[model samples]
Target: MSASLLAILVTSVLLAAVARRYDLSSLLFLVVAGLTVGLIPGADHISGIELDPDLVLYVLLPPLLWSAGLESSYVSLRENTRSIGLLAIGLPLATTAAVGFVAYRTVPELTLAAAFVLGAIVAPPDAVSASAVGRRLGLPRRTMTLLGGESLLNDATALTAYKVALAAAIGASTSLRAGLETFLVAALAGVLVGFALGKIVVFIRSRLDDPLAESAIGLVAPFLIYLVAEQVEGSGVLAVVVAALIAGQRHSTAGYAARLQDRAVWKAVQLVLESFAFLMIGLQLPAAVEGLKGTSAALIVTSALAVFATVIAVRLAWVYAFAYLPRLVPRIRSTEPPPVPGQVFVVSWAGMRGVVSLAAAFGVPLTTLSGQLFPGRPQLIFLTFVVVVGTLLLHGLTLPWLIRRLDGLGDQQRADLLAAAAAQDRAAQAAADRLDELLSDASTDVDARAADVLRAWNQRRRQTAWERIDDEGVESPMATFRELRLEMLAAERRAFLADRDLGRIDDEVLRAMLYGLDLEEAVLNRG
Candidate 1:
């Protein structure tokens, strides 16, 4: 294998192992590992292995973002729409303005347009990073929906604004009216294209008998919609979002087989894509640092801190102001869900930058309208890298601790409610069991065989009884069964490890065995 490929494989394994052991986000480990590798003499070659930014952005991001959007419950999003709107649309604009003002003032050589470009590049939070961390933290579904929705919409808005800013930097005059008109047209065009493409895919999916082939189409849908949308000068982000949403909605409603296959395929695809994205993110750090050569360390540090502070401060202000202000008023309050202050705070802090920002920053044109090199391109890229890494590490590491401190731990009441519901379901099963038995004992026994099977199921569904117990009660049959399963798992793991150490079983075989054992243990514990 080529060194780059080898590096990726080795780094991936190492990061995965470390992340699992330490209970850390895999993204964090992947990035840190990439940086370490990049610092090595020959590792810079890995940075030179470039792919097209458009391919990564328009092609890759849409599916990933769309997947996140599809997974988001529309009901939750509707509940938090106002807060999401304020954060996604309102916060980005506010942050851009704040950063633009500061950048233009601090860097006298940089034009106002250039300042805005910088702001726009850093404005949108990364949906992938936020989702990965948030899910692990057990954030409320509404909070996840708001964060996902905001991140999805903001990418398009920020990118659009960035384009305008870039044009202005090259001395192209832009009218607000023209910008608005363009945005509306582009958004509408994207929606139309997305719907059209989605319908075609849905038609194909419906007719396709093979689950694998149908899933393959679903995987390719985002890239296809994105490319088509971009060709028509539409919002590729919006197109992808709409396409994924349409596919997900139609996925289950289409039929049982389509739903089963699509769900399985999409879940696997999501895991692979997410892993690749984060690993790539880690590998880019050395390149970013190298791009900052000759720039004053102090200046870069100051600018990064200033930009980070501006981004965070602006978001906090926007969330608090917009989300709470409506509640204080009677007239507009009727329209929206009352924002949860804690959730808003969490969302504000979850603004970690990732692939989109990196791609956009790097995609900054090398030459202006007059063919002059774009001013401060390298510095801008480096600063953007700083913000992405800083926020990811800082927030990702501290978030769990913060949740605990804020008493955002798993809600016991919610868990209890679910448990109670489960108990009620068990009771219903018991009643159904007696009914089946009564019927089974009767002379009219045409479905007696089915009833017998139903009774067996009810026996399995018996309600778990919890009672104050002495030592005798503590060592129940279930507990004894669990102890035996644990012993079996330990023995199996030992055998696998011993074989692996002796080279009789390869790592893959060993890993598979261990995974199987782990799964069995999980099932046993659940029982």
Candidate 2:
């Protein structure tokens, strides 16, 4: 198992490289690679890499959710609350009902309760896939925000519904009223837990000096919050998302070192977990198919097609209906303009199912309370794998093309530059004012040359920002300055390397110098 796990990691890395080189979605490629590897001879060990349901739910989910939440903007989330709420809360429930009804009628082996369980499993579209494609294709900021915010909250809704549906499937005898009560209690508890934890963590980290210690706490936070939420019968997904948003909003208060280190750490963690997840999806294909040996091929194909089509069709209907319906109200119409049809279409098609769906399916108990095999457990898992793979391939591959075909779509580059320039100009003015005040202090010994140099650099920073906003193709003066500066920095870097090679400077000294140069280059590149 260890050797197989290692092999999985290595293959994931290579696939990641391929993804970067080709500028394609890693999720798409990794799953295909997993399927290819699993089908090949002498690679049975790869298939033996069992995806532990608990690991996916407990170990994998928390950090991924936290990282996502941490990066999400609270302000944007609040601004798009109505849209996100619809997609996150309303769409999932609607999808559950739509798919449940379809699955129950279409699949012979699945009971009504079991059919609902499958509904809950595949309802929430994975935000990671949507966000990845959106970013690569430069989707509008508002569109990105809607996709991200919905992803953060939808899991809570779907998972809560899954619990209710699963309990009924296992003969626990639950009612609609009881399910509603459970959801309310879980959601309320999760928010309280998240708020308390977020406040406590922020306070503690503020007092801490060590970046490593702060980062370690960040690494532990999601798991700790998740376990606590579950222990209280709360929604762990909601708790993690809320806490992350809280922490992210206050991220600027942290020391520079902690911010830098935490950013790199989370990126690495996201990469590894996402790779493992998508790969496992494809690797499990053979097993999912193997479980259906005795089932009629026609039934399997029909059931898969029915469920997959229902998932897609329902989302399209939901997104389009809600996009225009609320605006029919006079008050709503006055406040918000009608959404562009293209953006609505993109959002609708972006409903790609991911690892969470598969994990939830795998989590369905094998037997009922009466010790009988859970109705259609094997068939349910098979359908889930089909939906997951189907949505990913179908949506993930076409989303970029769909986005590009929309004329003038997401053309916000110039607006972004203008906004950035305005902010930079104001900040530079404030810095110059502070410098003048410091220089005027009678008690301080301020050098005249140093003050002039500082003023010049501050002025240059302000100029660089405005210059970047220029529509003209010709290079500005600051651009020439940057080019010359980079050349000098490159030469300096080569000199340091030569000194180290000649034993004239210690490696530690060389590293220190290179670090300084790196920071300078980073600033220059930003300009």
Candidate 3:
């Protein structure tokens, strides 16, 4: 990387870290900081940093999608498929049409095609912020799952629409029927490509014992799947998401070492990429503004704010419509419970646009096929910038307060914990049964003390899970055990390090012992 880019990354990361320290939205913080810096005198170098559209779509997006997919709960996703599908596919298309129509009517200079391009640009909400806020607020599992699943697939919807709209803007023939066909083909091809690659990766990783090699493959897989799918005229976003979901489903079968390394590596990668992307969203503000030189300031402000309002309003309507309208059917009402108004409202308000919108705007063609300047290209880009930053500041800042006000979800969260405790109890019982079966075998030579230790461990695991649902003030037995066990583990770690320092233990032996201690601590913390 160039020194300038490295500096930008460091600066962005620092701003994000500060935001995180104070429980602020890091993405919003970075964007605001970037905008502030961009406006400073002699900060042209920062604001002038140009990014290729392909860099955002091809290079930056895939890994982020992959990371989210890997971390997603397959069970939750399956259960909430209908909700996710509505938000991912339907919402994007609706927003594209709604925003496109609004933009076309609002900006006299903008062609219908170019307006739709702008619409597609800002249509998809980057759920990174929504997911972060939802997680921090301890939103119910189903809500989080819907957010995760929507984030994974919504990009595909927006980008596919973007392609069709862009083709029209550049003077290519496109009709509603053709656009629908294109979307269907892209979605199908992407899923097939991603599924095939995902299975291949899983099969290879499952057979491999090398953590470093597995990690390398995991890192490369996203980009590879994206490129291959796009090469076949499919939605690269869908391909990456599909491959990630497939790979995530098999994640537990991987070696412990690979899983540990993956957690550290992917976490760092996500932080760096997300920070840089959010900062760039802000840093590009000057260029976006510079593009509209000589344009009426009043016109610019009115158009931008109008588009922003439209974006927010459309999401609210779409979410609420989907949440309730389907349940009006007698059959549907009988099959599914009514949607929680609080959850639906939270989902609606969490629609913050991100780097992708800016990237799409920046990618717009400067000139049409007839060699005429693409109508309102500069204005559209500026409008997109405004919408992104405006939504970020508006929604990102208020979501926490909104979630706090609508606090009825606490009961649902507690219910989820109770369900988890029940599941843990069954799993622990099964483990104990398997242990007994192993011990009963004549070929097994385990010590009686070792057998007792295993049995106690299983019982403790069950108790720990159940303890989570106990009264908050209660000092449960499992909690006490965890506290004491953690202290003991810390002591063991210090002893191991002391032995290593005194040259009494080999480095490899120390690492092995430390790994064991770390795994135990991880399990305890997880419980």
> Which candidate has the highest lDDT of all?
2
RMSD of each: 5.9, 1.7, 2.1
Q: Which lDDT value does model 1 have at 225? A: 89
Error of 2 at 336 (Å): 1.4
Highest-scoring model, TM-score: 2
Of candidates 3 and 2, the better by TM-score: 2
- Scored against the true structure, residue 386 in model 3 reaches a CA lDDT of 88
Better model by TM-score, 1 or 2?
A: 2
Off by over 4 Å in 1: 1-10, 48-51, 254-260, 291-293, 331-339, 408-449, 458-527
Task: Please provide, for model 2 over 168-275, each residue's C-alpha lDDT reduced to its tens digit, 9 standing for 90 to 100.
Answer: 999998999999999999999999999899888888888999999999999999999999999999999999999999999889778888998999899999998898
Lowest lDDT 10-residue stretch of candidate 1: 463-472
State the displacement of the C-alpha of residue 378, model 3, in Å, after optimal TM-score superposition: 1.2
- For each candidate, what TM-score against the reference? 0.80, 0.96, 0.94
Taken over the whole model, the C-alpha lDDT of each candidate is 0.73, 0.90, 0.89
Candidate 3 residues lying further than 4 Å off, grouped into runs, are 411-413, 506-509
lDDT of 3: 0.89
Residue 238 error, candidate 2, Å: 0.7
